[model samples]
Target: MTNKKRLELTWIGKDKRPKLEPRILLEDVARSYHAKHLVTDNDIFDNRLIFGDNLLALKALEQEFSGKVKCVYIDPPFNTQQAFEHYDDGLEHSIWLGLIRDRIDIIRNLISEDGTLFVHIDDNELGYLIVLLDEIFGRQNRITVVSFKQGAATGHKAINPGVVSTSNFIVLYAKNKTLWKPNRVFTARNKRDTRYGQFIDNFDAPYAQWRFITLTQAFARSLNLPIRGLKKAVGDSYEALLSDFVVANAPRVVRLARPDYDAVSGDARSMIDASHKTSEILRLEREEFSDMFFVAGERILFYSDKLKLIDGKYVAGEPLTTIWDDLLSNNIHNEGGIEFPKGKKPEALIKRCFELATIDGDLVLDSFAGSGTTGAVAHKMGRRWIMVELGEHCHTHIIPRLQKVIDGEDKGGVTEATGWKGGGGFRYYRIAPSLLDKDKWGNWVISKEYNAAQLTEALCKLEGFTYAPSDTLYWQQGHSTERDFIYITTQTLGADQLHALSEDVGTERSLLVLCSAFRGNPERFTNLTVKRIPSTVLSKCEWRHDDYSLILQNLPMAQREEETLKKKKSAHPSLFDNQDA
Candidate 1:
């Protein structure tokens, strides 16, 4: 067998991986906002808004949300991308890729088999990000890259000498390409269609007696002007005048399209052939085919069929395309009732993501919450959502904006369009602090911050067990399987205590006992596996380490381990503390 050479994006610290702690969420009751009364029967009250570092947040959600989220969208910081143009081997660029790679790996596991992932990035890191995602989600699972026209160069930007940039990109990928099926969607078009050039003179007449005329002639006749005098009459505004006429008589005007020989459906080809010979308009009578109109071998498309109802007005629309210039970002400053400076994304953009990949009630996740646009849009669209943010704005901005959405008082950005009368709610949670801390002697130990329950749960997560303590059995604090159990405690267990625990475990069952100390003859207890706490967990993770940061606004310095030890030595001159076991 031959080994395959593969291409991948490499950076400093790319090989070193983080063993993220599966930290538990602690909800703040006062911060979690909800509607006073239910306004709709489908009001969702279980959405989550997490305040913490996003990478750790993703790890915490891994166990319960793995392979369950239907859609995942993240918009990470892109300011560091300024390094890409200069081609400097900057540490910030490497750190950006490293942190983003970590989040993407975790997110891939969180998405369902049929789910999709959308990463919003600008052009600077877009190339590198595509390669990274291709490696994680497989090159075959890549769907498309959308070029979003966030704004047009105007105001101060217009004075710039060189070409101005206004486009950002959204890279899309499926968790499993074979199982993923995306919904077809249409977006509002910025311009009207000019293809409906033919107007049926007697549109309501029977098929055999129908008369067709060019739209220019029809427009000229309406004004009692001859066809030759039309161009001189309307002059430069002729196209605009014809467009207005087409909109008014949209159903009567038609565009003639020839059917592709090989690609056209069997029924359509047959219908086109029969119509050409009979010289009559035909309607596809087959129930299996969509209702279609054909005249003399050409498919007839009415201007009315392209109409889309948008913003309380019927306008032209087309299939959603890779270039998304129609989404305007002009007045986004006043939206969401909060000011996030450069971070907040428009809700309509996220709503389109939901329309493409999910339905109402599907679960959506955004690890980089960044002004909480994903959660706010998901809430209004009736999708359950989870958002993670480490910034203080998680309170100052996100919670208040979400409160307005819940109270139905927010009347901006898709709210009026969706008919959202609010009535949904989200729970607020913050990531729990680390479970282990170092002693003054530089020895690893259980943190004093954890209470008994928190300690047991943290240990359960580390040991790969479900934390479900049995009410009847004190020895069963957690379990990996039906008959396999784990028990943790701070007390020392002697030979007699070990024997008692083993007898209770019985011969058919097995138990992992994690205690401060255990004493026994090696071959005595067949049912129990004994180990000491702190020691068993010491090598499993980067214990008590805060060596890195996910934010890449500037070059980061690693937290000095020696400095930490010195500080701890000064704080605790005596090694033994009152809580020591």
Candidate 2:
């Protein structure tokens, strides 16, 4: 066999990736209702609830929101071969991989450099999902795999022998590890103890409380310096220098090792030796000290002084570990008052993710907005959020739940814990239809549904330009660079029209004119590049078809069927979707 080098997870169709359309979002004002109380002077109506397929929704968000989102928490469907009430959870292994892979790729683009992504999944696909994530986010960017306890015990444990699982996994990754920094979290103080109640006169009144920490044998040995002159002054002068150094340099907590007498061999022996050396130095400094030789076995002490004091107790907040056991259960019946039968993420869980990953007013996105748990939690936590859900529950569950959150009528889940007397709102939006479709002659053309403004904006996005229309210049729809602009129109341009446009455009800048047809021949203008509209945008992305999820069966045939048939007749076979054709 020939030696291959690419280290990645491969499936049946691993090489195939979807060419997603950068669709536009259209706000549905009729369905989009917000409470008056939630609207404050600082309130921005940028919070969105998109009702459509998440894959398409992510694509729609790409151009405007690329590298803008601060956090993403998704609870995608677990391939458990189980049927869900709103969505089908079961899919073929390869098809499931393709669907998730496509969405993951887009999500990676949507997150900022310092942003984080949390994927909630079960054991059924955990191994494969981890490998896939490692490939996309890189193995180094993979933060941790947290095992969240789902419940105390399940009936399945009785039937399945020996080490049955009652937990789900949350895989966390950052877009860039060097820039990502999770917020420090503190739990409620359960006990009160003052073991290291040392006071320093050098520190100010509010910051007087401090704890003493002993230097570890490893640390002492690592220093490899004499301890003789290190402890010249004990009380005032030493405290001043150490406190100043710690405050200025060591902002985080410093850990020191406790001497272990039993394990005094190998590396521990070096620590013991360093301790004896330090004791000898102290003995020389303080000549009148009693039992100087006998005290050599004692571990050296080092003051940390960086401990936080809250309610008369020094708080060393327990850093979040890989095993998360205290999060709320997903099986809560009345959570957010939306009884989603399957895959409803607990509000507490999402709240914890936000607390660690983002601050207030940061943009948070949840493409898999099941039961709107992410939205409810994000809103109460004062985060700006955008949630997308494909199923009909977007109306039945997500909207009502969010409305309750805005009205301060929601009293369940993390409401009491977060002190949320809610006051925020999200505007509802639906992904617009594809911009381009094939006509009866099988020629690519702009869809009839697009108006002049919509067509201009769509063309700008397709050509990698920023839409910045000016009333002074009617043809100035958008611009790519400061000197390069784009103009879009549906009308066929004749010679006089082209000459007028070129004269207005001038030689100082360049312009790309996208029209239905152009009649100017022999490279007359140097600053203008005239191109046809639909033909130019046709090969840029997969158009006309919306949904990209992998489902075994179609949803219930209702009024949506007629809509589907209409789309099918207009849509042509793109490179990505030609497998069925």
lDDT scores in order: 0.84, 0.75
Q: Backbone clash tally for model 2?
A: 0
Please write out the lDDT profile of model 1 over residues 291-321, one tens digit for every residue. Answer: 7888878888888888776645566778889
Off by over 4 Å in 1: 1-3, 81-91, 197-253, 258-267, 277-279, 308-314, 546-581
Task: State residue 135's C-alpha deviation in candidate 1, in Å.
Answer: 1.9
Worst 10 residues of 2 by lDDT: 192-201
As a TM-score, model 2 comes out at 0.75
Best by lDDT: 1
Clashes of each: 0, 0
TM-score of each: 0.84, 0.75
